[model samples]
Target: MDPYRRLVRPALFRLDPERTHEAAIALAERVGRRLPRAQIDPALEVTAMGLRFPSPIGLAAGFDKGARAVDAWAAVGFGFAEVGTVTPEPQAGNPRPRMFRLGSDHALINRLGFNNPGSVVVASRLAAARARGRVAIPIGVNVGKSRDTLAERAVHDYAAAVERLWPYADYVVVNVSSPNTPGLRDLQARSALGEILTAVLDVDVRSAEWSGEPRRPVLVKLAPDLSDEQVDAVTELALELELAGVVVSNTTLSRAGLRSPAAMTSEEGGLSGAPLRLRSTELVGRVARRAEGALAVVGVGGVSSARDAWDKLAAGASLVQLYTALVYEGPSLVRRINRELARMMRERGIERVADIRSAG
Candidate 1:
């Protein structure tokens, strides 16, 4: 009965991964227009970062970098959508052929850079979506430095994005974690991250004043390749900065257990999907244990099913994200997970998804 796996996926998988991704987004935008809003169970609701998401599952940022598919996420059943790893201006990103599929491993390695059409364009698109009454749920805007921006100047670059998209966003994410951009990961260090956070927090205050609105939440996303010491350091910094929360992980640089051919495995980019599930879940547990209720955690990287989502929540993730799974499992994955997750939650006598966070 699954048409995506039976027909759509077979055809999409036949093309190169990046182009297929583009086609998927275009298809989503078109399909989203005709689809009815996704139904949800109130028990699946999660309130975090000062907003209430109808479900704990969200679509990660890379899937809609330019905010071109705001309505598509809601139409497809995501409780929320985090869009853009957007920068100040448009860039071609790395050269083409940058995304590779590892069907044997159910994973993807992508070095797409932050190839968004820039913050202005993304903000405009989001604005239009809002005008049309399309944003049915919270939209988190993930902002990062431009590829050409130096480490020293990165703070201003991030500040610029938060300023540009501030009004429309339900929350903002500071992405110093993606490996595709040169020197981007270096910003995760204490001093560098402190500077960026300070500037971004200032920008939030400015946006609040400018719009006469409440200050929006700003959280940090970290690359999974960080050492324990580094992870602890970043965690401490997040707590110190009093951030809205932390997204426990971004794509990883590790290629430890991939079954894909060496050529595909050797590709330079962050690896996401099943291979990342365990490590990211552990990190979620670690960070959750470390934060000890001082901060919120959004678990991402490798969730695909109800059990996977359960693992993340039990490990202390208040919410979770899906990206690569959508590539392999199709759109129904979110709703299916929500349905099964609700069943699991009910068995435990819990009414809200938030109750299971760190339950184990």
Candidate 2:
């Protein structure tokens, strides 16, 4: 482990999780430009969802809520960055003290409730990034329903956000996961998910025509708490809809194996980070096995080290993403994880990252 894992992250963790996150973004924006281009081994490059990623390591959504720090994160060596779980209308999300750090478990529980500046503001920032040519790799926009959006009108809510942000995003994700959103996860029911995906993809096709570019790829993010039956249904829907892929297993509401104190345990929200590694990995593997190459799987949750990432890959993740680990491990963790991943790939005599998509 890097010395910062022991030294720097501990200090950062002492601060409130949300405040430290903002501070980290500010710092990255200041110094990210100076960081050299990440030296990723060619073997690590993989194209998925119609975009080329320098490596499999990506920053998951909910980290950059407003698409405000794309260049900063890209400079830090993430192969791809997903921003926002933006809603149709701007929202303050849950009240303060919504994010809590469980350092002992390398986990975090947050009820931020998609606190973002809404799709319009995020679209403007992304447009600016594109105009400035600041984005180095594919950037995905994850869209969700507004808290006030009724369940019956979910399609309209999602379509509105998709139409607004589609031009700026290399790909779009229909985030029906996120445990913090009431009635959100219910949308993952096969019938509900199908309607949402169909509506979003329809918008994507029209948006592409308007921009004179190929249709942007669309994927759905699922909750980790799903049953195998739900996973199977979602996998079928993906194939039926001809979606680009699936983002297996978002943060879980389940608090199993959390080693943090009882006070920390009392906080409500989805749990992510180290404590989630095993269950998330298992879910990824199951999805991969079930999907059977029908659609790509972007494995996320609890990926802290190269070994954890490799395990996810072996279990069937075409790409891997992390958010909570970055909180506990520091910015340098991205490069370190990629480098070690390359080494591990070499040790395994693998030529391409996708070659191990189901090594398990």
Candidate 3:
């Protein structure tokens, strides 16, 4: 283990997970500004969704909830960065102590409920990042429903957010997967998902016309707990709408395979990290096989090492993302994973990262 894991992470882990997250983000922003850029090989760059990515590895949404740390994360060797789960309106989210660390399971349980400074604030930050040239890679913004919003009005809320942030985001993710948000996951149903996506895509079309650029890619992030039938239904919807892609999963509510004691496991929230690896990977593989080149697949969940990333790629992920691993392995995790992935690629005589998109 690195010195930080042995010494620093343990200390940080002792604090409330949410507070520790804020502190870590603050430290990364402060320290990242002073650090020199790490060198990355040209072969690592790949293009997808009409945008170029320096690497296939991206920092997932929910890490920089309000687009507050894009520059810092981008500077740390991320191919791209996704911000938010931003709602149409700002929200305080669930009560305190909503985030828990399961060190033994290499996992996290968060009921953050898409707490953010709202789409307006996030858009302003993104606009500033663009002007400052601090956001080079494709930046995707994840939008979710407001906690107070009723399910019947979810489309209006989502549409409003997309209209505000579409100009700044390289792509927009309609998030209806987080289990913590009451009735949020219900939006995954075929009819509900279709309506939500239609509203968001309409905004994409309008933004394209106004800017004279192609319509930005719009994707949906799904939860891992869905049945295969549900996955197929969502895939069908994605294909029907000509959607850009699907983020294979958000955190899962299931607590299976947890090494943590039963008492800790009983804590309410979505579970992310190692325990989710197999299931999320399997879901990605299934989606990739089903989508069959019609849509993009962004694989996330339980990815902590290069091998884990490779599994997701081989299974059919055009791109891969990580969040919880950064909490466990530190900022250098991106650099380390990319290096190892490149080495694996070279070992396999692969010329491009996308070459292995369907290896499994």
Candidate 4:
């Protein structure tokens, strides 16, 4: 039996979702050295954004918002791990009770409001992790604007994050889709998104030059709630920006077809997990059709099973990530997904995630 679901999850679930997460992070830090290794499959190897990942299954951002326990992800057997949704300045984030669990739905609702210790502190932690040689896999930083930052000034916050965090980031994820932040989604529009990407890309260039490092890969995270036309617009924008990839979604506010209680389901936050799978995969297909394979797509949302992960790949995602699934399935979820994915590919005389998409 999966120890997490059999034992750990029950105990953790007893507390609120956020508390369980915090407790786990603390435990990971103290016992990470003893954590069992995740089984790695050769077929799971993938190259995206000019970077190689040991596997395509990665831990999505929002779990390690402060960049702490970054090194623990590798020990837990993730192909990669992304940290932060950090802003330029620290903010308490919406009020208490901002995070909730919908166990019946295998989903989560969070209005964390880009909560973190701010970019500077998070950057320092990441730098420290890199210097200490703590991480076993590639690490990306997810950057966003602060709550108090006006919509027009969002670019400055993004640029600042890229400038300070790219030195330690394998890539930088520009998050403009979180429903928790007011007017943040407005940045997803063509004109606004273009300006933000332009400023960040410019800073990315200068940061590379100043740090004497190679140009860092930049990606934008989109929302699952966008209209089909909006998805197409963002795809075109990403293509024009020549971005490394697009993280197919951040979260959604839609509670359609959810089985959670009305109160929990009605909470104001982005929804993630099983409820989001079909829509997210559908969005991946739309974006991929629009991309024509020019840029990469990292799939997130509702990937609780290998088939779900495979579905995303077949639809056009070169990589996949999950946060809520881990909460419900356990850390072994990574190894299980990779093993099943590799087996599924081998059975079809296929190899690599991209081939899965190409075959379709």
Each model's RMSD to truth, in Å?
1.1, 1.4, 1.2, 1.3
* Candidate 4 regions with alpha-carbon error over 4 angstroms: 33-37
Candidate 4 TM-score to native: 0.97
lDDT of 1 by residue, 1-360 (tens): 688889989899999999888988998888887787789888998888789999999999899998887888887888999999989888889998899999988899999998889999998999999999978989999999998888899999999998999998999999999999998999999999999999999999988998899999889998888999999999999998899899978999999978999999999999999999999999988998999978889999789899999999999998899899999999898889988999999998887787786355
For model 4, which pairs clash? 273-302
lDDT of each: 0.90, 0.87, 0.89, 0.87
lDDT of 4 by residue, 1-360 (tens): 867788888888889888788888888777765565565887788998888888888999999899878878887878898998988887778887888899999999998887799888988888777787767788989999988888888889898877778788898899999998889999999999999999999998888788788998888999998999999999999998899889988889899999888988988889998999999999989998889888789999999888998899999998899999988998778888888888899999996677998776
Q: In model 2, how large is the Cα lDDT of residue 213?
A: 92
> What are the per-residue Cα lDDT tens digits for candidate 2 across 232-351?
889888988889889977899898877788898889999998878888888888878877887789899899899999889999899999998888777788988988988887887888
Candidate order (TM-score): 1, 3, 4, 2
Minimum summed lDDT over a 10-residue window in model 1 is located at 351-360
The better-scoring model by lDDT among 1 and 2 is 1
User: Candidate 3 on 129-175: residue-level lDDT in tens?
Assistant: 78877666789999998988999999999999999998898888999
Q: How do all models score by TM-score?
A: 0.98, 0.96, 0.97, 0.97
Give the poorly placed runs of model 2, Cα more than 4 Å off: 1-3, 33-35
RMSD of 1: 1.1
| C-alpha positional error of residue 300 in candidate 4 after TM-score superposition, expressed in Å | 0.4
> Alpha carbon lDDT of residue 132, candidate 4?
71
